[model samples]
Target: MRHRRITAALGAAALALGMVGAALAPAQAGGGHDDGPATSYTNPVTADFADTYADPAIIRGKDGWWYLYATSDPLVEGGEFGLMHVARSRDMVDWEYRGTILDEGSAPSWATDTSFFWAPDIRYVDGQYVLYFTVTDTELNAGDDSAIGAATAPTPEGPWTPVAEPVVPPRPDGGGFFWTFDPSMLADDDGSRYLYYGSYYGGLWVTELDPSGLRAVGEATQVAINDKFEGAYVLKRDGYYYLMASSANCCAGPSTGYSVFAGRSESPRGPFVDHEGVSLLDTRPGGTQVLVQNGNRWIGAGHHTVVSDLSGQDWIYYHAIDREEPWLSEPGGINRRPTLLDRLDWVDGWPVTRAGAGPSEGSQTGPVAGSLLGLTVEDPAEGRALRGSYRPDVDEQSGDHALVRGRVWTDEAAPEEVHVELDLRTRRTEPFLVRVGRGSNRIEVEVNPGERELHVEYGHGRFQEETTVPIPEEYDLSVWTALQVHVVEGQVHARLSESRLGDVIAEVGLELRPGILRSAPVELRGTGAHVDNLSVNAAHEPVAEMVAEPVRGEVLVEESFDDAELDGWEWVREDPAARVEDGALVWPLTGADLVGAGGSGGLLLREAPAGDWMVETKLTLDLGDTEVRNYQQAGLIVHADDDTFLRLGHVAIWNTRQVEFGKEVNQDGFLSWGGHTSGPPADTTWLRIHHTTNDAGEHLYRSAFSTDGESWRWGATWTLPAGSDARVGLYTGGGAQPETEAVFDHVRFYDAG
Candidate 1:
């Protein structure tokens, strides 16, 4: 039995840092497993080097140090500022300032007296360092000019020389110039280069860059829409290219709602969409939120760069404003955006910061900060379980690697991250597999040469739909290929290389639920073809911790639904089908919603307790198992009006069932609505909305949800204008199928706990 990446019937699917810093691999990937060193780290990553460094870009220098660059800002309060800042670190935590890249003495000739540089993007191209940046205004043009410029450097800390002109000159838009900022460079598998740049005013775009990586060569294609996102960063993982951009107001003192979101496509030039398959260019744009404020002191977390530590773990470097000390000088002066770092985890094929914990406010385990793991097969091929007609070992060509004819499996361990690396003969029609679990719980990979694709399947006992990643055309399967698969806690990432130290030709990934691969075994299964150079390694399992939100204050106004008579509550639009029944409020779901187009759905509202108070609701609504239920929700809502309010509910959007805490406000001439999702739902979900006014008198609403009704996960915060009499109550709407209804047990208000 040639056990595939999974069972023959199904398929399955997948950190560290380095100290020579794995500069040998692409910036976003693992080099070879070269054990270097390990160290712990924490953030404000640049607190020791600078007071405010925003819109960061990072790269691993050839010298083995991780180099970081940031937007022009004062390094200290009321201190002299620089055009752009640079720093270097070995552990990715402790950093040393290497001084500014540009200043009065080193300013380019094309830069005007008032012009300045910002958002430095550093890349290693054609044996030298290439730097792309934003020029606020140039000597060649006037009237609101902002464009991207390029420079070349011999090293990370540079004596940089400017290119002839702006790589992407500012274009006129509505009497002014479109924002051409936040430059990021990419080199595709085909050897073509690209530059992504733009801002909230013009949208993010990707233009073909010349081989020099210093100039744009073709018309641009919009990847993200304007007025919603900016600060674009792109990453190629598995087989998809991800567009990660920041949304909301990036800077607004303590009120900043800035956050990060992501979309993905298979090509470098993308028709990208969020996790729900919603296009990024839609009027009601879709974005999978990746980073946000989790009720911590850190707010406005955005503009990030992604990197891998020596230990092969993925980490994101971003900037965040400390809510308590957001500004450096006067109130609402310059936002003190200290650099922060957090682990980036992939769940459901989408990226989320800190496994949905958001920004880190306390201490955290840092990167392994070390090289690529290498596995070797013994001459006698020891430990391999030979199944059926499989032979133990033989001299295939010059190496004495395992010659696989029938089937075999090897290497089992406890539930932890597992890394397997080996060389395989590719051209053969027979399939090869890398299994990371035993029994039913495991990830399986199938290398189908005929289809030129990798079929992946995963499960606890059963399995999921197979994900197919097409092989890159550049890959020549006739020769030996190095296959590296990393089975982390909840993700399976695999890449195929030309040789043991060759370029990665194709990559693919599959995300599984956590703990699926318990203390299991890593096995290699093959049919017909023989293999060699097999090695396996697993990390020491990590201890998991849970953070719970405390219940604020005593229960002030507890509304236990026990009778038909409801007191102190009024209906916005009465639904005849809804009534108090049994021991709960049994409200039949209505096929209606209250958003952009206005309200038709009924709402139950009650006067909110004065001062600061917390409101919570326990509800049960069967939206069925993961199915498309567009916005069908039932829970608590604090309504000021039909058009302006805040809602917390157990809602279904596409296949994802989550607790959505959303805010809708009538701004300008239309409605603006957005939300943040919290804890994964259960049969009985507990939703809470905390209310507190800031020093500016703005009413702040933060949400929390619990699956077990105890261990709560506090999520993002949304704000409302001060002095608004927002009533708090419950309702069920946005869906009107006869199959679903909400049973609300009670609505409780607590004073400050």
Candidate 2:
């Protein structure tokens, strides 16, 4: 259908069937320029520079800012992807990357250089900034047809213009055409508009538009069902009208479970249903979830876009996938898709996202949208920028401060892009600095909350350039957290939260060779801490400056069990109480679950050391929480027989607790299955896979994960069938109740160079 690209910063009196309409248009979203008071985020939400801000599409710019838009691929990683992305913010949680809206000398002179472009949507109607998108391929005829363009921008960071054709063309079919992919648009409070579009083979329609919303005037209709769904997104509320879309199989790495559902209908087009009434074109349809994947570290949470704020609430901004990194550099490539933001709520009338706990990972209460870009509230004891020991109070009545034995700079010498935010609490584990540029081209940063580390440095002292890292042991530091720091362009990222809305834990980056910094004196150093809100502004100019490389291979098979020897391994149902303590391998979980007829679970296979390899392990599995333990598993496999295989576990299913990554075949005769979802297992999770082959010969087996295996994240990719001899297993069992054990700790194996 519409694989998925997500984002949304909307509003404009939009509402439906239940009434409500017109009333948004006030949000500045981190685009209002963080003078901070509300806005406590968490969740990918474009983690400072697109790692993959897929199918998003925000829009909140009556000049206050917000604008987002994404889909063309890279803003990072090996680079070069397409020119469709755009970024801006002042509230959508502080973004800024902007470069891209059509290139190759401004594309769309009739599209068809293979035509690219994708998802998009944005809207602002009559006053300008329209957008819409999804061309895919065009040149008027031949195969890949796909259409629906349109553009026009006055500001949302666009030089835009587009629209000379395709407002919904190509329909064809058999000889190839159907996927006119995700578009969206809506409007109506009598002002009409409409648009929508299609996928999964000619399904989700809509039509109407015209008051210069760039064409598309007339019949169309349809609504949902063609092959389940595509990325639709409708909106309306109370009187109904909902719709939403996105279904399964989104870029399967680590077994993506692409979700989002919903149905409603008081009429934006026709009969939608769900909430039990079923029919989204029924065949087996039902819908009604509204962003899935709550097994944590986000999974393929569908393409979306909602927006409301200004105290009205709503929010949404979709695009997930980090079930262990999930793609962007080999392992079946390009899929990262960060950009997330939740809080949608609603309840009896539908709309869910956060209320149902779907994407959000921590730190909540945010989204007032925009209102603060005013600045200057200083106090630091009448500003001279403190120096050796410091003092000030505020915290509950204003900005805040308290450093104890050192620097605080920043009263005038700025520029280098800045964007700091310290909120402190620590008392002393030593290190503390923060400097940013100037003098000898700075970049310091000691930090050290009792060994959680973070020792940076950069061009001074003895020609510095240090490194370090770690910092996310739940970074306590006496409690009130929220670090942040973001020197743009030449890099120097930093994160570590707990309060600026919490749940970031750790983040780090560095760069700057000759690209050095220009305006320095931003300092902050400490020896006691408790600063609580030191802000430091001046940011918003990001066209590119991302990081994430991830390759690491080497070792070949380390094992590490410490005692009980199992030689080269080869069991299947062994379990004689399984032992080997000290270094791990415990094993217990048993309720025997091998899926279809091929049942019983114990496994342990071996023999598999060909080329491009990698294995990794570290299970744990306590499986207790909430209710029904219907699943209760363990992980790692890649066999070829037991009905063909591929596992990855950290299961529990019924009351949510995932890290799935399944794939059982045996198709023509029956078994076939599904799975995908990585990252977020913890209590000792750490899985890994990586076994390349590509170039079309297919072998591939990628999927990575970690909670503290020193920052990992990779995900997706799951092929096989290239000579197929596979082998490589490790198991435990589905649930049987109580006694759930499964320890493991190390199984290593690598050389995936």
Candidate 3:
């Protein structure tokens, strides 16, 4: 005869790393555990490299040292100085950040002092290291002549000598070959060297270079061209040449669309094939493989150059938009893309990703549950019991007995009804009733009336239903939670227990409360009972708390190019649509531009933008639709203006498409930042903002999903950034919403904390 309890069930659901937990298996045969290299999620430097730098280049020199070169600052929007930087990694995981390898100070006379560096293709040719790169016009107004150039050095890092003039054809009249950039030099297995260049509408082209690796020997042939692409990196594996390039609009803070796409050709140059054999120049899929994403050790990783480690394993060197400095989606901010590196696991001749499949969950922050609640197993195979103190209501009208015990009933128990004999023998003269209740958050089930009969109640919120059970045989009450009770109010209140309402129904039982006649020995009993992971109703009521707002403040901005006065405030990069003069920031256009098929732009300012702050930025938007997808309005942000900041932008998604007809989207149109929650057509809108904190110590933030930015309603609220006192800044980006561009006029802040 097996005595079992009906209420010993545990909730089977557990969440791990934002994913659902799988069912557990009975003890496994432990012989196959690998004892080599103990590794866990805590292991640092496991998978840390990512993204491409502007115009990447690499070479394994004769001296057994591997050198990599990249063009500097293609992504920097208006910085004064620029130079070539280098990094070296022997194992590929540990890298030494070597400073600037080359600069305008070392540039040849043929190249202007203000020429910006593009891509640098380096190789060990003959007895010297030949470095080939492109130099662009400086004035932002000087169109193109920013063509490719070259230099030579005896070693990887050197006191170098510049080769005279541009190595490739000079920029043509109109847009000069879309500005020659992304140069790659490949030494074929057959002892021949070739240089690849040309981007934008000009496509991919390859020209033969002499063994010296400095000058082009023959005319360059058009290789491939289609989707205005750049950052071309060519590699030869298994007798096939693979051309990898960066595709799509790759800027803007939290809102960026950047990825690497590839095409393969049997020859060094020809019709390259994508997955569908569609000419890569015409129909390459919008980047099939994602090297990295947000919440990883690396983010905004693209524009890469792949190199071989000393062990022959391929390592990709690229730049990642540092989590500290996110890409601004809005206009009023600087455009900056940093360099980062990572290894690409290749199988079946294609690059593979261990991104989501790695041992530890990617770098996203989550709720903190310090330790496992002190839970114990009452029955090894089926039941687990959680122990805690329970205070109940008792009366003094009857004998010296006032207590109640709760128990659960579940399918895991062998008997139809669990035998619960309470330890009432300790007080033979005292009479008590036990009660039980069910449910997790709120208990609805309860039982009463000891040896004579038992009563059970089931209900929650407002609706409740109950039942009763009768007992005949008399056995000494065992000192256990399985069957215990105390008499208090004559009505007999049931002990509470709880279960998750979304799934199974949970049940509980408790003894009724009988009055106490006199003071007696107080010994707690019925403590080890198997109860479902349900909630137990309490005899006493609880108190609730109110919600509050987060605190905000001001400080100087870091990671910026500011060298002005420190008057307790910071100046932001100039907005492309505005002129900065006097003490005030002014804009030529009244509204932000909605970048359509081509794209849009804008910027935002930041005094000290991080930590948690309720930001209210005023934007003047024009309600018009862009003919492209995902394009919307200029956005506002808090947290440093880096790629990691949060965005508060608008949408013209609800705007009519007719507004973009007959003309291109490069004009001035004004649309107020109204609360428009719908898709597009976000014209004529007002703005409202809100941020708050909860009792759980978490910050909640949200915006108004309204038409008028003023008369706004609440939108979605998410957790705040995870760090100590950070900064805040403005943001603006291009999207596929309805508008071409959105503008910002003014912004204000408040201390919510």
Candidate 4:
């Protein structure tokens, strides 16, 4: 059920022989160090459907529920089967894996013969629910034309019944074989239904569906035929029809690769060309826009589906090999492709990944499992006396070890470096190093200590053992560090952090095993180091904290905000023009408080908050010009602790005709209050905000605006670090049409969420 792997710090101790040979090696054998803790999408809001989903398709039903369908292992099986799984969610983030919804084994006679059922798309047509999918021949890779079938049900998850025979038949072209597969359907304004289907082979082809919404109306027309295409999607945007498809090889795990391509045409059928003027049918690399690439942590990314949100934002979902997992044994090893999903932003009508920006820090923010991979600890646990063993005869409970103050230890030298080679199944992000003690001194493998200070070390090892190489002390890391191990010459390294430096750790005279000694033996001495917030690289951005206190170590705030003493901080008016009473900053809006004709004003200070901190403020606004000043705002200044900070508060004015209901305010000048609004504001509103760093290099500035101060909602999330010297202050400046003052109250800052 829950598959896991151990940290791969020493496994690379073995050569890249076949999987079996590496598996049998002793002491850091089997390229074991090459496997590191697996990092998935970490943002809870964006990570959904955390399962081995393939050929993913999502459709929103009229009932407001979004249904997700995937073509393989819907019920969590180890082997491949022609079964489609189902999942549902109201918000795209939290998906409830609903097991199997459709299976081919129980299919109608016409479909039972097919084994490979793939790319299922659901649509609602004429008060009826339609499911379109492709079923391949039992030969699998024989590449013969497959049949497109139709099924219908009232609900999204269906005990579906077949509507009829193949909706689209095999190709009539004379290319030896017409492989029909991966079908998607879209309805046009004139009541015409179109189906787009194709494989990674020939190209994407389109056909008209009969009014009954089953079978082809006539001969299928070749629409877009790019050789690098597969998993095609058709949707209409701004009156123009678009076909989105993935190009290149896919389903190959870490090596699996492809790029999303797009083509536009007036009609859903006929000659479709990419933006580069290349024919859709031609297999070319440069013909399509590269939406994603492989490098650093992400080796392969492609095979995607795009979905639009309530705000018109489109999201892209695809599968990629979790590079942290090594290549599977031969054919099956490279086939475990993990699904990856990210939000897509449209720049000039062209889709691009908002999170994927090459292999750089702050390029992506993914989700993680709700719980750790069976490992338990606090936010900042240390690694001391932590020993792991891979003994063939040891049991799980027996070999398990605990990290103390961040170190592991052993009385005598073990045959291997700690127990790194024992349990290769557990994956951990906690930094661990082999440490062995030798009387007066100890040795270490320079594992990341999670601090910015220089860590002492010796030697780095590649999987190849031709020669044991040494590394200079001064190891630094962030989110981009790859798994690495250090080897000592001569004596087999013992202890979790102990290593025989041949001439360094006592003249290479120690026996490799425990309870044994050699006059000139080498010993692996030193314990593993485990620290909190240890990223792969050393340059990742920090997490957002309501307040930052370098004096209290790193801002490791994972919960609420409270401080015994508000030390090293000052309470200055967020709005300079506003008055301060009872030691609380307040803004009182008046005619003079309003910016003059075409002018602007609010408040500012000279200095700002340093490190990772967040600020929030409450405000009220009453204004005129209900039409022109609707989105007015008042809020806090982030990045800046003082005058020269970035402010996202309201812009509405004061004293204008208005309407009121409950907490809703309708007026002109100095209207609505709170953060991140552009036009005007409502009357008497309170805006509170939070701005801070994202420790995992999630560079984006995270801020939430709230109406009731206690209940916050996400407003705008962006990346404008502004280099750290930024301060916080209030500012209300907009609309030269007329001016009104906005009021402010209740401002505060804290260390974390």
TM-score for each predicted model, relative to the true structure: 0.59, 0.32, 0.42, 0.41
lDDT of 2 by residue, 1-753 (tens): 222322110111112111112111112222232233457777776787877878787865543356788877766776777668888876778788878888876667778885678888877554456687888888888777878887786666677888888888888876777888888876543445677878556668888877666888788888766654688878654345677787656665444667777787778887888676666765434566666664456667888877654333456787877755676763235677778887665545566665455676777656654322222223344355445567765443223456456766665665565556554567678777778787677887667887877666578434666666676442355645545555555556555443121123444455656567777656777776756435455543211211232376778768888857767888877877778899888888768877666677778878778878889888877776546586788888988777667888777655446576776665323454556544346657788887877655667676677757876655555676668887886887776687778888788888877
lDDT of 4: 0.41
Model 2 stretches with alpha carbons more than 4 Å out: 1-38, 42-56, 63-90, 93-120, 123-127, 131-168, 171-176, 183-248, 251-297, 301-316, 320-339, 342-360, 364-536, 540-713, 716-753
RMSD of candidate 1 to the truth, in angstroms, is 14.1
Poorly placed runs, candidate 3 (over 4 Å): 1-58, 68-70, 73-80, 103-105, 138-142, 173-177, 283-287, 290-297, 327-336, 355-753
The model with the greater lDDT, 2 or 4, is 2
Task: Report backbone clashes per prediction.
Answer: 44, 40, 154, 119
lDDT of 3 by residue, 1-753 (tens): 100000021111100001000001100111011111111222122123212244445554332234556555422333333467555543333444555566666876666665666667675454456777776652223454556778787766776788775667464646444557767776553446677886655666788876556777877777665333566777654335667776433443333334465666778775666543545544212222324342333333466666532111234555444433453222233334545444344433444233212111233211110111121111111223222233222212111222324332322211111112121222222223332232311222222224333344423345554444443222122211122122112222221110000001112233222231112111222332212112111111101111222234442222221222423434344455553334323334333342333222344444543434456545556534323433344445444322223445553222121011000111122111211121121444334345554455544445443344543333323233444233444444444333234444445565444
Model 1 misplaced stretches (Cα beyond 4 Å): 1-37, 330-332, 371-700, 703-715, 718-753
**Ordering by lDDT:** 1, 2, 4, 3
User: By TM-score, who's the top model here?
Assistant: 1
Whole-model lDDT values for every prediction? 0.68, 0.64, 0.39, 0.41
Poorest 10 consecutive residues by lDDT, candidate 1 = 1-10
Order of all candidates by TM-score, from best down to worst? 1, 3, 4, 2
Writing each residue's lDDT as its tens digit, candidate 4 over 1-753 gives 111100011122222110110011111211012222323233222234433566677765433445777764322224444367777765555678776656654454465454556677776554446778776652323445577877887667766877557887655456645667778776553446678887644557888887657778877777654334677776554334667776545543332334566666657784556454444643222123424442334434555665533212245666544434523342332234445556554333434455224212232333221111122212212242223331122212212222233323332332222212210111233444434334323334333233321123332232111122222222122211212122222222221110000001000112122322222112222232212211110011111112121221233222111332323334443334555444444444432222213223444432433554555556665544334453344455543322123345544322222111001111122121111111112354444334445544433344444445553433333333325455455555444344455555544555543
